[model samples]
Target: MNYFKQILRFAKPYRIYAILNIISNIFYALFGTLAMVSLFPMLNVLFGKTDKVKIKPEWNGLLKVREYSEAYLNYYVTQKADQGNDDVLIFMVALVISMFFLKNIFSYLAMYFITFLRNGVLKDIRNELYKKTVDLPLSFFSEKRKGDTIARISTDVLEIQHSFLSILELIVREPLMILFTICAMLLISVKLTVFVFIFIPISGFLISLIGKRLKKHSDKVQKEQGFFLSIVEETLGGLKVIKGFNAEKIFNRKFKESTSRFYNYSNTLLNRQNLASPTSEFLGITVIAILLWYGGQMVLVEKSLDPGLFIVYMGLAYNILTPAKAISKASYGVKRGNAAAERVLEILNTSSPLQDKPDAQEKRDFNTDITLENISFKYEDEYVLDDFSLRVPKGSAIALVGQSGSGKSTIANLVTRFYDVNKGSIKIDNTDIRDLTKESLRGLMGLVTQDSILFNDSIKNNLLIGDEHATEEEIIDALKVANAWEFVKDLPKGIETNIGDSGNKLSGGQKQRLSIARAVLKNPPIMILDEATSALDTESERLVQSALENMMKNRTSIVIAHRLSTIQNSDLIVVMQKGKIIEKGRHEELIAKNGAYQRLVTLQSFD
Candidate 1:
């Protein structure tokens, strides 16, 4: 219930629709009760029990209001009785039909308004969930499956809409209908209505017992759904690897195992949910059967209660059954909804560690240089970079040459503030990067990674991510600067060409070059290239290396280099080993030293 209350806040934006729905439901309940109560007059007319009255009934106080109303109705019916019983019967039937007609109309209207409120809340929740997903730090996702996040946003949200949102209708309509029906039954006879109340609590208790474990089962089913979805997402991402390794049967068996659990959990949850309706209905029938025997004794043998009124009381009692069944079903829905709301709120309530400070300044420009001072960081336990210090003077290409696990890429990540340092500070022009707003800090740099990260979008649209308002001529110029225009100009749609998933439509070199072009379009003061050409073939590397060289000119660049031949012209080549710089000098000066740098050059020459 606490989780449900939290989810209901999303309904605030559509509160007007909620208000409208409540109003319509109120009328629907009123008319629905009246439709059943109208049976009292019709029964009296059918039984020929209506009596004629000569005098108009006097207005009585509220205590005898029921008697006064019955006298007035009898006076009117007696006037119509002179017309014929057939005509009076027709009028009574017409009155019942009108009540039913109005009840159904309000019922339709209640559903109509609720549609807007329900879907509006759905849209708003999904939108907020997506925004939260994007805003969370990368480290948050390190321990979570992508498919679980997807399931929370997609299926779990839908479950909330179906289950929790239905409570809005049940809250107003069902209880009001029951309240009105109970009031009318009390007007007819308080003793029998008291008997009806006794069975209700017992029925409610039984229904509750069945639904007690529904939430636990529902949680298991949703988790299994996420598990299977994760397997599918993994399978799609690594389809080629799976085929190359011939592991289809392995994945198939894994998927089947997950689904088998899901099947059992779903059946258990649904069977419990399905039990609510019949259990409530059977309990209601049992109450009804008891009322018939007790009321029969009072009417036929004791002659204390009227037959027509008892018949009407039975109709009103029967009217309580529909709403009771609905309420019992909705109780189960609320339980299921509680489980779903917990999953959704888990994401929404997570506080990102990377949030900017209240007084964080917006630093938009890069003047002077970037510096790392005694920075220490870690992803989990052991530090990836410890006491790492470096400086990049403006407009100089500083290349980091290192063996794998030498923390070259870790430096790139720290510079970009993708993950902040555990100790010490990274400063731009002497101001700590943490003091600057993340947006403005990131705006000063461009990044190109080992993998060419491109989306399944138009080539033009992909470049627009770097500069959304870039003109055609500016885009073409950036492409030329990255040496990508040659291949791009040959494609059928040229700049407008759609690059398929992750730009798989382009060759490795073409993809890498476009990534460079995107960075060039931003034209930032600092650039970080993390082994950007390592995955390419010889020919592709040559082309991409040329593009990198062109883009790095006159810019402050940090290059994490793999191919020893590529960074020979760099202003400073810092060779690192085990997170520490073992050698630092220009390429020619390092070659003259005949030490670690020279050894690396010699090894590459042999390769």
Candidate 2:
């Protein structure tokens, strides 16, 4: 119930729809009772028990509304039949028909109104989850699989919508119907109704006991599903590697094990959930058998109840079982939904590590040098940077050159605030980046990694993400500056061509150039290139580096260079070893020093 209350907060904006759904449910319950009550007069007509009492009689009490409505209906039918157009039996039949019609009509309205609230809440919840996922720190993603996140967003959230919300409707509406039906049954025969109460509680206790295990099994099923999805995502992302290593059988075994466990958990959950229907039905029939024996004597042997009245009481008694069964099924559904809801809320409830402070200010521009003052960072147990310090003037290109794990890329990430430093400060123009709004700080820098992260979207749309309001001419000019215009112009649709996922449709060099083009279009004051040309061939590297240098001409740039030649003309080159800078100077000075920088340059010269 507490979880449902938390979920209902998403419905606040659509409260009007929720109110309308409740109102319609009220009418739906009324119609359900009225439709059952309508059977009484028809049974009377069939048994030749029509009354000649005052038809439109008024009343005052709890039953007054029911009595008045019955009287008004009786009078209208009798008045019409007095003209010899129809018999009293026909009028009673018409009342029964109208009751059923209103019953279904109100039911439809209730469902329609609830749809608006359910779907609106679904949209809002997903939107908020997406925003939270994007807002969370990069370190959070580093610890979790992307596919598991995808499973939470797509499959798990939708399951909650289907399972939880559907049960919520039944929880609210069906119980009211059951209550109204039981009350009417009591009016007919309190003795028989009291008998029903005994068995219902016993059945409910059994059903609840069975359902206690459902949430546990459901959680296992969902967890396994996430594991399988993670495997699929990994396999697809690294299909080339899998094929190269001939590891298909190994991955297949892993996937099969995960799915097999999922299958067992699903079976456990479904078997328990499926028990609700048959268990409730068996209990209901047992109660009815008892009533048939006891109430039969009341009708025939003792003359305690009329046959027609007994028949209507049986109908009302049966009505209670329908809603009771629905409730049992809904209870199982709620348990299943709880598992998925917990997963979804796990993501939604997680607080972002990098969130704007209440007093955070938006930085308008960078007017001075960028400084890393004795900055230190660690990823979990491994320290990547230890007391690292560097300074870049307002518009200077500083290239970092070192071995793979020398913390070159970490510097770029730290400067962009992708991951917060463990110690010391990163200041832009003397203003600590932490004090500025994340959006404002990020807006000032453009980043291009080795992967050239591009989406499966048209080239124009990709460029538009850099500056959504950029004119067509500006997009084309940016592409030209990145040396991507030649290939794009040769394509069938030019900038409108769709680049496949991660730009797999483009060559390695083409993807990097397009990436550079996007950064050029952004036109940020600071550019971070982390091994931007590392993945390309010699010809492509030359073209990409040319465009990169063009873009970095006046911008404050941080380059993590893999090919030594790219940073030869760089203003400063910092050589890192372990978690500290081992050398720092121009390329010529590093060669003169003949240290780690000199060894790296000599190695690249041979390659």
Candidate 3:
């Protein structure tokens, strides 16, 4: 119920729809009860029990209002009976039909207005969930599955719609329908109504016992659904590897296992949910059976109740059963909804560790050098970069040459502020990167990673990500600078051609060149190339290296180099081993020293 209340806040914007639905449901409940109560007059007319009164009944005070209303209705019917019994019967039938007609019309109106409120909340919740997912830190996703996030946005939200949204209708319509029906029953006979109340608590207690563990089972089913979805996501992503290794059966078996558990959990959850309707119906029938016996004694033995009115009382009692069944079903739905809301709120309530300070200033341009002073950082407990420091002067290419796990990429991540340092500060000019808005700080730098990340969009559209307002001439110029225009011009649609998923339609070197072209279009003051040419063949690497050299011409660049031959002309080459710098000098000076950088050069030359 707490989780359900949290989700209800999303309904605030659609409160007008909710208010309209409530008004409609109120009328629907009023007319629905009146439709059944109208049976009392029709039964009296059918039984030839119409009263004959020549004089009008006087108005009574509120305490005797029910008796006065009956006296007035009897006098009115007696006047109508002067036409004929057949005409009076027709009139009574017309009254019942009109009551039912109005009831159904308002019922339709209630559903119509509720549709807007329900779907509006659904849309707003999904939109907010997506925005939160995007705003969360990259580190937050490290321990979570992508498909699990997808499940929260897709299936869990739908579950909330089906379950929690139904509560809105049930809250106003069902209870009011029951309340009106019960009031009419009390007007007929208070003793029988009180007798009906005793059994209601017993039945409600029994029905609630079935749903106590419903949320627990529902949570398992939702989690298993997320698990199987992850397996499918993983299989699609690694389809080529699976085929190359001939491990199709491994993934197939894993998928089947996940689905098998989902099957079991769903069966348990649905069977419990299915039990609610029938159990409530049987309990309601049992109550109805008891009422018939007790009310029969009042009419037959005590002579305290009228037969025609008892018949109307039975119809009103039957009306209560439908709404009672609905309420019981909705109770089960609420339990199921609680599980989904918890999963959804878990994402929405998560506060990102990388929030910008309220007073943080925007730093739009790079002036002096970028500085990392005594920075100690860790992904987990052990420090990946301990007391690491570096300075990059404007318009100079500083190359980092290191073994695989030597923190070269860590330095790149820190400079970009993807993760903040544990013990030190990274600054642009003199302002700490943390004190600058992340967007403005990132705006000054361009990143090209080991993998060429592009979307399944046109070459032009992918480049537009760098600068949305870039002109066609600027795009062509940027492409020419990155050496990508040569191949792009030869394509079927040139820059407008669609690149397949992650730009898989293009070759490795072509993709890297497009990446470089994107960076060139942005034309940031600082460019960080992390092993940009390492994944290409010899000919491809040569072309990409030329593009890299051209792009880094006057930009302040940090190059995390893999093939040492490419960085020979760099202004400064820093050699690192196990997160610490071992050598720093020009390519010629490092070669003269015969140190670690020279050893790395020798090793690459041997390769």
> TM-score for every candidate vs. truth?
0.97, 0.95, 0.98
TM-score of candidate 2 versus the correct structure, residues matched by position: 0.95
Q: In model 2, which runs have C-alpha deviations exceeding 4 angstroms?
A: 54-86
lDDT computed for candidate 2: 0.86
Mind giving the per-residue lDDT tens digits that candidate 1 earns over 1-607? 8998899999998999989988999999999988987887788877778877868999979878778878888887888888888778888899999999999999999999999999999999999999999988888898888889999999999999999999999999999999988988888888888888888889889889999999999999999999999999999889989999999999999999999999999999999999999989999999999999999998999998999889889998899999999999999999999999999999999998888989999987778998999998888988878888889999999999988888999899888888889999999999999888889988999999999999999999999999999999999999999889998999999999999988988888999999999999999989999999888999989988989988988899999999888899998999988778889999989999999999989898888
Best by the lDDT measure: 3
Superposed Cα RMSD, model 1: 1.4
Clashes in candidate 3: how many?
0
lDDT of 2 by residue, 501-597 (tens): 8889999999999999999999999999999999899999999999998899889999998988889998999999887988999989989999999
Clashing pairs in 3: none
For model 3, residues 137-256, the per-residue Cα lDDT tens digits are 889889888888999999999999999999999999999999999999999999999999999999999999999999999999999888888888888888899999999999999999
Once fitted onto the true fold, the runs of candidate 1 whose alpha carbons sit more than 4 angstroms away are none
Quantify all predictions' global Cα lDDT against the true fold: 0.91, 0.86, 0.93
User: Residue 271 error for model 2, in Å?
Assistant: 1.6
Residue runs of model 3 more than 4 Å from their true location after superposition: none
Worst 10 residues of 3 by lDDT: 45-54
